[model samples]
Target: MGEPEAARAEAALTTYEDDKLKFKVQYPSDWTTSTGETPASEEILGGGARDLFTISPPGANARDVNVTIVATPAGADFTKMGSLGDAYGFGYGLVVPLNKPRAKKGQEDRIQFAELIDSVGKGDYYKVEYKFAKPSTGINSIFFVLAGLGYDGRVSHLYTATAQYPRAEEDKWRAQVEAIIDSVVYPPTIYG
Candidate 1:
C-alpha cells in the first residue's frame, strides 16, 4: 500500500514495514535508507553507543524520524535508567532529570517515555531509549535516540541502535538500516 498519510494532523501517520528478524522498522513511501552515515537531521556518533539511523523528510511541519540501535552489556539493569547515564557514559542518567516532567493531562505512558527521553539527551540533546528485545534472528539490541529542531526549523536527532549478534551477523543490521534510509522522502537537494 502507498504510504498512509501521517495522522494526528501535526503528527502525520505513515506506512512502513520491518524485518522482524532484525527488529528493525522501515519508513513510509518515497523514503529511503542509508548505512554507516547519518540521514538528514540525524547524526551517528563515533564512540560510546554505536548506532545507525535516518530522519524524517525535510518538509513543512514534519519532524525528524530515525531508527538507531545501541547496546547494553548483557545482564545490565534497566530499572535505574536514570543512573545508567553517568554509569554508561551514553548520557542516559546525565540527560534525564531525577524529577520527571509533567505530561499533558491524560497521557501518562507517553509522557513517561518523553520524560525519559528528555533526560537521556542531557540538554540540547534529544532522546534516549532502550529496547533489549531479541529478534527472530537471535540478535539483541540496545536502542535509543535524541531529537528536536534546530533554529533552522529542521529536525535534529542523535540515535544508536546497536546489535548484539555473532560478528558474522553484521549484514543483518546493515540491511535493516538500509531499509529505513530507503524510506525517507526528503525535499529535493538544492545546490545553489
Candidate 2:
C-alpha cells in the first residue's frame, strides 16, 4: 500500500456508524457518495457486490450522487461459485484513470491503495465496500467477492453500502460526500 488512508462518508441521505469498517479512503471533492443494501434473494459468496444502489442524498437531485459500491471479482466463475439458479446481485462502477502502480509485481492484488478522486483530479469523496466472495458468518448465508480486473478491465471491486433513502433527500449529505471520499488513504506502515 502506497499510503494508508481511511474515510467517513454518507450516501442517499442515509447514515451509518462504524458498524464494520474494513477499510476507508479519502476521495476528491468532485466524486459523489452512493449507498444501497444487499438483496434478500441474492446468493452468499465472500460478501461483495450483488446490487446497484444510487441516490442524490435524501433531498436534492443534482451535483451530489451517492452510489452503492457493489462489485465482485471478474474472474469468479458463477458456475464455479455454484449453481446460479435464481441468485440476485447488485453493484455500480465509475470509469476512472488508475495512477501509476507502486508494486513491483503485477497490478492486480498489488493495488493496495485505490480511491476515486474528483473529476478535476481533486481529492473528492467516495463510498467503498470490500468483500471477498465466500460464505458469510452472519444470520443469513452471504457470498461476495472482491475480484480484480479479470481478463477485461471491468470493476475491480464492488462498493456496496446502505443509502436507504430516495434521491431528493440527499442534499446536505451530498455536499460532504466528495470531501470524504477524497480523503481515502492507506497507512504507509501497513504497506511495508
Please estimate how well model 2 matches the true structure, expressed as its whole-model Cα lDDT.
0.30
lDDT minimum window of 10 residues, candidate 2: 134-143
Q: Tens-digit lDDT track for model 2 on 1-192?
A: 443343232222323222233234333334445544554445564554354423233444433234333334333433221122111111223212222235465544434322232222111112333221111211111111221111113322323232222224345444354344333331111112
For candidate 2, the TM-score is 0.25
Q: Residue 66 lDDT in model 1?
A: 34
For each candidate, the alpha-carbon lDDT, in order, equals 0.33, 0.30
Model 1: CA > 4 A from native: 1-21, 37-49, 58-92, 96-192
Clashes of 2: 70
Report the lDDT tens digits of candidate 1 across residue range 1-192.
655554433143244322211223444444444444323334464333223443333331122233533222212232222323432354454334423345566654333221232224333323444433223234233334433211111211222332122224345443433444333322211110
